[model samples]
Target chain A: MMRVEEKLFQNRYRVDGARAHIEIVDGDVCAVHCQDKPCTFCCPAGCYAMDNGGRVTVITDGCLECGTCRVICGEHRNVRWEYPRGGYGILFKFG
Target chain B: MSEHFDAIVVGAGPAGNSAAYTLAKAGLKVLQIERGEYSGSKNVQGAILYSDALEKIMPDFRDDAPLERHVVEQRMWILDDESYIGGTYRSANFSKPPYNRYTIIRSQFDRWFSKKVRDAGALVVCETTVLDLHMDGRRVVGVRTDRDNGSVYADVVILADGVNSLLARKAGFHGELKPKDVALAVKEIHFLPEQTIEERFSVKGTEGVVIEMAGRITQGMVGTGFLYTNKESVTIGIGCLLSDFKKSGIAPYALLEQMKAHPAIRPLLDGGEMKEYTAHLIPEGGYNAIPAIYGDGWLMVGDAGMFVNAVHREGSNLAMTTGRIAAETIIDLKARGKPMTARHLAAYRKALDGTFVMKDMKKYRDVPAVMDKNRQFFTDYPHLVSQAARTILTVDGVDKKTKERAIRKEFARTRSTLGLFADAFKLWRAFE
Candidate 1:
């Protein structure tokens, strides 16, 4: 099985290096509120992860723009999700 | 001062393009806005183009469309852990000209569609995000874009925005989408040589095959998987309900990995190199979960209205049909000098109800709920059915009747007789 990063490598993206389209409103919400960090698992791109320091971080570069992370995080409602700026983020080669 | 148009169509996917094309061809001033770099840059689907729908919109589309392959065969599979029981339908009639359906890559197909929209005289703009709806009190009048001084008024605003339309929710048009209402799907397109594709799929020049699968692959989730063949590539993917993924704690990508590893599936993609992987949400809420489709100056088409018939795995057709009908409704209303008000726009819903869009949705309205409650259908049934197949087919010393009785006993033991009967009734009612 290919790693998610390896899988995403085949796709194209014009990254908005400075601006993150998806934001974790509260970094500690996952540690304090969530029993199971669903976003880390449910995100198709595997964009969100809780590191060894007990902090949840989101990388927007590989984001599929699917909006799954926000919906599945109903418990904390901490994902401030939005589409990237026009012409940025994912560009499907053979969508 | 912002310019006012006859109609503002949002999103450049199938639905939006359909509306903009129809209105433009009717000589109405139309502005079609898309957030992508190009028409299909942000869209993805299993993407089987039902010619009937597009034919109604543009009768001669086949002459110049960016089609991949025409479908001549369809396979429906019920997969177990290692084996699958399925049926195939291949028809020579489907091989004839004016093909019933064709496989398409959404990005290229959408570019072609937007070209048609522009050629029809609709003003198609890309790389511009529609931030919100411009409303007078509760009635939508136009759209607010991300651009400076981007407020543009239109007599009718068609929301062909895709499933994750924040505009629909922010404008108080619909409530937040429930987890069960949407399925999160991940698909990868594998590139193979044209000859290799044709040889593997047992098809020749421009012919394609589509395999829709169910049972076990979704890991007991109320979802399905699919594999579609293109001219030189094959697209394979799996999807489950958002709620199911949350509960099962299954990683979305991991599910696809398991599906790709299936014995019945893996061999076909033996040497193909994957070129693109994508993930998107599908509106699977069916008829009952559909929001207020038409109100005041706005109409919601495509997945925005939850128009997908998940039972048949058909969405683009519904999107195209709803879009065309909505545009037609607006054109008719304008011809009669009727205002695009809530009362007048009810015709759009009426038009849809009279078409297969609403009728098919209504017929399978109970499907989502049935699949939601019946976890056994995705789990136990596959094992039971496969076990029965293995038992009845193997040349054992046992007699045929004895094997049949053993199969029945196994079913009764796995799911009590009463439970089995109730399950059958539920399935019947859901499909009925």
Candidate 2:
């Protein structure tokens, strides 16, 4: 099976290197409220993760802009989600 | 400083393009803005284009539209772990000219559609996100974009921005989308030689086949998987409710990988090079989940209004139809010298109610809820059905009557007779 990252690598993106479109509004919310951190698993782009230090991190570079993390994080409402500014995110070549 | 137009359209997907095209063609001053680099760059679909909708907008679309294939066959599969038992509907009539549906790649199709909108005199600006609606009290006066001096005024704003319509929510048009309201779909386009695809799918020329699968493929989730044959590529994907994925803790890509490895699906994609991987949200909430579609000086179309008929797996058609209807409502109101108020724009909703967009949505309103509660249809039932097929087809040397009894027993084991009846009744009520 291809890793989620391998699959995401097939997509095109004009990454907004200096900024992230999706932000964890409260990282502590994931730690205290969500034991599983659903976004860490449910995100199609594999953008959410737990670091070695047990901190939640969201790398928005490969976000397919599917809005999964935002909607899945409904209980905590932790994701400050927005579409990437203009043409700065994943660009689907064959969408 | 601000620029104003007769109408401003947000998001250049099917819905936005349809609204922009219709309004511009009717001689309205229209400005359509897209956050993608181009019209379809951010868009994706299983992509069965309903010609009737486009025909209503541009009757000559067949002339140069970048259509991949006309669907002449449709296969519905009920899959188990390693086998599928389903039916195929193929017709010579569908193979004839003036097709009813055609497979499309959104990137190519949307670019062509935006071109038509531009040719109709609509100003289509890409790479510009509408940050928010410029509201004066409850009335939307214009939109604030990411660009400098990006506040653009309009008599009316149409929000065609796909499912994640943050602008609509920011403008307080709707609350945050419930997980049950939208589906997270992941798709990959596999490239194959044209002749190879033709021989494999039993299609020639522009003919195509669409395979819709349900059952274990989604890991018992209330979702489906599909494969559509394009000219030289096969579009394969799977999606489940966001709530389902959350509950199952199944990564979307993993579900897709399992589906591709299914015996029934593996051969179809053999030797195909996957070139694109995409994931997007599809509003599957049906009728009950539809939000405020129209308000003072603004209207919502497409997935923003939750127009997807998940029952039929038909979204682009509804999106285009709603967009066109919304545009027509605006055009009619403009012609009558009426303001684009909530009262006047009620015509858009009323117009949609008269079309299949609302009718189909209303008809299948109960389906999603029913399916959500009924797990057997996605899990045990598929297994039972496939087992029955295998039992009946395999030469076990058992008598026909005994085999029939065994099949009944298998079904009864999965769902009791009363449970079976109730499930059937539930499905009947949902579909009815």
Candidate 3:
């Protein structure tokens, strides 16, 4: 019945300032969010969520950084991907 | 001037963490470089962590590691369209202290292990991609990263990167991983209340079950499906050889959807909210697919060295074990003030051979090949067996002898006696 304690802080490497931001510009909508967005079903982290108007929004914070969205999102070129600044992404407890 | 350390490890997953932890704990200066923003950021698993290997590294890990459930039961099912024929093993002993295996979420586990590495005094850097190896005439003396001013020298470099290790390939340590040597796996984690998971799996708090399956699920491809009960969620996945998937023209997610809809599987996941879905590549090439493990001033561990034992669904454990062994080898060499040469580092290979990592891999080296070549095992045989079991078990007033004879006919109809015998022989050879 012993439980494993989760790690509190993880060390990461990332750009220092505004340059480290992952930007999604308005005109950069690479693919129109469809009624049945495949990313909603395929993304493991549920990072891609659809709104009432069916506009797909991506929250990169919860991203596991598995690259599934990047590879499977062939319909869109909007995912300007890069690793989060060193020490700031998903940290696995048991992986 | 080049900065030198006792060791530099690339990719801070299970392998890199293990090596770094071991070397640093032994008073050696170890630097671990990870491409992900942080360790475990890019990792995924239907993860069952074997305690034996991890215990070797962190003996009192159970006191600190974030484990979901200790697996007391394991079920292997052979599924047809609607029915399945499978066996289960459950033991109270498995639930006792020092449990054999535990289910884990990779994201949490890798973070914990990495923390242990840092606490052990290894300098760990993340979000740094190693562009290539820095060689001094066949001696790998350092790594050149993508970061500005990123070139760092070391006495040795251990490549613990996972399956898609471009560094090792670019360094000419191995060729491209053929589709046949890898499997594309897709998995989803369905979140349910803890009580629901226990009720569905017939276990109380902290007890867990793992179900492994093969059959019509893969659409006749050489592959398998799995469902593991975590504390409050279920990990369901299906994976097929990349080559088989490519040739069959089936998307990995489609296969996972089909598996979720399976009659025997659907009920367990009923009412569960689907939370996370992810896919990853598993290196299944076994012993033969292992590339050069050690070179001048360099070593390879984990998936980068093709250390997975696919037959047992074990990769992380192998990765950790190989990492530990590699670190041990380096520590021993350094203690003797020996140079990090390929000849000296061959101890890593010898240590691996003496461990279950090499032994288990060697034992099942032929399984993937055999299973790939024999489509019937994944398709026809499961259907026939499930049908026969259904027919025999259903009481339709048919004579018992008739039912028995019908089962025999089903088996014989699908495979000739010679074919059946060959399957048994192949299985034996694969496992022997």
Best by TM-score: 2
Cα-based lDDT for every prediction: 0.92, 0.92, 0.79
Task: Report the C-alpha lDDT of model 1 over B306-361, residue by residue, as the tens digit.
Answer: 98999998999999999999999999999999999999999999889999999999
What CAPRI grade goes to candidate 1?
high
True contacts kept of each: 0.83, 0.88, 0.27
* Model 2 CA lDDT for position B405: 99
Full-model lDDT, candidate 1:
0.92
- For candidate 3, lDDT tens digit of each residue in B236-276? 98988776765675655567777888899999889987655
Worst 10 residues of 3 chain B by lDDT: B245-254
DockQ, model 1, C-alpha based: 0.85
Which regions in candidate 1 have their CA more than 4 angstroms from the true location? none
Model 2, residue B292: what's the lDDT? 92
Q: Tell me how each candidate scores on DockQ against the true complex.
A: 0.85, 0.88, 0.15
TM-scores, each model vs. reference: 0.98, 0.99, 0.84
